[model samples]
Target: MKKKKISLGDWIFNIFLGLFFTLFTLICIYPFYYLIINTISANDISANGQIMFLPKGIHFQNYIDVFKIPDLASAALVSLGRTVLGTIGAVLGAAYLGFMFTQQKMWARKFWYRFTIITMYFNAGLIPWYITMRNLHLTNNFLAYILPAIVQPFNIILVKTYMESISPALQEAAEIDGASVMKVFMKIMLPLAKPIMATIAIFAAVGQWNSFQDTLILMTKPALYTLQFLLYQYINQASSLAAMIKNGTVISTSSLATMQTPTSIRMTVSVVVILPILLVYPFFQKYFVKGIMIGSVKG
Candidate 1:
């Protein structure tokens, strides 16, 4: 059989599509690039909008200033601990709930599934949640961030959907081998569900990493502050800036000339906050892509 040659129109259309997508990608990425550059560039240059794709005058002093904030390192440790523990809890809980929902013989499965789904669309507002947390004595505790969001309903549904697509024959074979429910889940189902598990792990990790509201509301103790909440406090406290000035903290006069140039500090703080997650993402990049592909097909 003679292979058909590419049509001119199809070639042109593809070329146009590629160019369009390239431009869109650049448009999306440039703002983050600009923010990164702006944070490192001199305050004067940033204020004048002279910094764009490149740093105008390189400086590490903003980062130094950020570090000098009291207990910044401790706050970072707290955030890291919370994120790790929360992600693990959520992934395990969601996976178990998802697997249970997938079982044909599970009693009242429809009622349980519907109950979980209802939580996805509705939430008891913040005050009521706060009151409940207080009643549970979770306020000002690390568990405040962990316990409330451990079983994400949407994640459960996603995992369950993925689980439902697994071959029934495989499950039956496991049963014939006299495997218990737990063994079937751990050995057979979990191995087969790696892609979705990876996806949920990433989602849960990122959500915990970026979470601020829960920490803000439930944790009032300074020692328990997560990175996000600590950064927020640093940003809000005029006294921090005033104390820096009073202590003769080595801020450039050029930076001080425009006191508000600490906007760059905000950008820098964001980069710092997200840097760990960025580093961790590449390790899971393959699994992440696989997970999305599997999820889309199953969902």
Candidate 2:
């Protein structure tokens, strides 16, 4: 094959494009960079706040405070459980139901499918939503985290589209061999649909792990709070505590002196909260892109 030489104009454009994106990427990353430095640096907390770029003094005590905070350990456990259970529940439920939607034999599948799709666009608002959860007795319940995610329409639609793209002959062959619908789904479809499942599972896991609004809305008990809600409360406490310090209500001579400043602790909490996702991402990186693309393909 003959090689086409790049024109000077093309060379200029490519260089410009590369530089533009490089700057944009750096800009996007700066906030996380700031967060990292602030979280790890001890001197920055007590210093005159002059330094922004480089980490001032290293300290793990901020992290210690995060772990030691009241109700936080329990909340961390809840967040972890919710991420695992809620992700599995949402992915399996959505994938199974989505596969069922592709089956012609399923009763009222169209109406039911349409109903679920309608839910994607509409909600009854906060009051009715609260009432419904209350009636279900989900208020102040751990089930609130896992149950609500089990039937996400967005995940269903993604899985459905990907499943529909599979050959119908696969299912028919299983049926001819005396395989039940459940067996076919369990033994065949589930295995074949790994990519899309992984993709949506990532989505569900991240959402479930990060969710705190539901806790705020439904949970009154401190024990029931998720890590995120605890973090939220910590941020509020940070502001309130700062106000107390400024007003001299919380004297430096008191126990507050030994306590990690709310700002430092808040940053530590952010790092702790996101650390799981960071660890989990590398495992999913290979399938993540493929799953998203394949699932989005038209059936």
Candidate 3:
């Protein structure tokens, strides 16, 4: 076989493409990297904006001091609890409802699907929503986080669109084999829909993990406080919190350079709050791309 030689234009375009993407990748990555380096760098250096592009005087004391705040552990536990439970509920609800909408045998399928989607575009405003949640006794309750977000209309639509792309012959074949709808859905639809499910799981998990407004409005108990909400409070009170930490912790001469500061506290908390999502994203990225691309094309 003969190899084809590249044209001058092709060679230049390839070079341009490589450089463009390299720059774009750095643009996306550098902010998080900036946060990381600053958080771990010496407090005085970070505060003075002297640490850029690389860290100086690296230390883990920022993380240690941030973790020392009262109720941080419990708040983190609550956030983790909501993220796991809410993601599961959201994925299952979206999958089941999406699958059901595809079935002609479902009672008033078109009407119900339309009704569900309508809620996506229309809202009764904040006061009514707050009143509604209050009526349901969700205030200051842990279930406040999970129950309200279980059935997201946009996620359902994505799931339905993805499932519709699957050949109906598969479902028909399962039915012909005397498989009940539940059995088919559990054993067949779910397995085949792993990509979309993974996509939805990532979306739900990020949403649940980063949620702050819900906590602000629905929860009043310290026991129910989420990590993001706590971070929010910390950011608003960064100076006082930093002062408190600095004053409370004994500052030995050796540790003075790495001691806490308002800027360091903010950056450290941001990193701590976002690191889990960053770590979890790579595992689901392949499925997320496949799911979103296919769903968009199918829709």
Candidate 4:
């Protein structure tokens, strides 16, 4: 094939596009760069409110201090558990529900499907949701993190619609071989549905990991607190940090002074909270795109 020459208009458009994207990319990167710089810099550099396009007087004490915070380890464990279990539960539950919704054996599928769709558009207010969870005795329990999020209507619908696009003959053949619905789902459908499930898993994990509101509302016990809520308390409640300083670990008055005047350790906490998701995202990104695009266009 002969190469086509680019028109002057196309050249101009490409230049503009490149410039726009460069600016956008810088905008996105700036915050993380600032956080890293502030996190690594010495207390004096950070306290001076220096313009930090680049790091100054680098040190790692901020991260050390963040680690030294009280219950941070336990809270991290809770967050990690919630992310893993909640993601698996939500994805598998959605997949199973999606599979069942397509089955002839499911009773009142139309009514239930419509009802699920309706719930998406209309929500009972937060007060009712809070009261309902309270009445159900979910408060101060780890179950609060995973159970409430397991049934994601949007995800179920995506999986269901994608499943519908699978050849009916495969299902019929399995049924003819005396393979039960559960067996077929476990052996066949799930394996074939990996791409979409990966996509939903990312969504579910990020949501569960970053869920601060639920912890704040549902948990009163310190032991039940998630990393997100712990960080939130550190930000909003000075007394909380003061308590941590008294009990968690000892830091110098100068370290404490930086927080009071200029430098904020909360930036380090933000980086810690976000770092895992950032690291994990690239692995799922392809699947996320593939799942949404294919699931949308075909099914």
Task: Give the best candidate by lDDT.
Answer: 3
Q: Give per-model TM-scores.
A: 0.87, 0.85, 0.90, 0.83
**Residue pairs in clash, model 2:** none
- Write candidate 2's Cα lDDT for 102-169 as tens digits: 99999999999999999989999999999999999999999998998999999999999999888999
How would you encode candidate 4's per-residue C-alpha lDDT over 56-155 as one tens digit per residue?
6676776776677799989999999999999999999999988998997789988887787688889999999999999999999899998988888889
Q: Considering summed lDDT, which 10 consecutive residues are worst modelled in model 4? A: 256-265
Per-residue lDDT value at 159 in model 4: 94
Assess candidate 2 and give its lDDT.
0.84
Off by over 4 Å in 3: 239-259
Model 2, backbone clash pairs (residues 3+ apart or across chains), number: 0
Quote the RMSD, in angstroms, for model 4: 4.5
Reference-based lDDT, residue 3, model 3: 100
Count of clashing residue pairs in every prediction: 0, 0, 0, 0
Instruction: Pick out the ten consecutive residues of candidate 2 with the lowest summed lDDT.
Output: 42-51
Give stretches of model 4 more than 4 Å off.
1-26, 42-49, 237-263
TM-score of 3: 0.90
lDDT of 3 by residue, 91-135 (tens): 999999999999999999999999999998999999999999999
lDDT of 3 at 185: 96
Residue 271, candidate 2: Cα error in Å is 1.3
User: How many backbone overlaps does candidate 1 show?
Assistant: 0
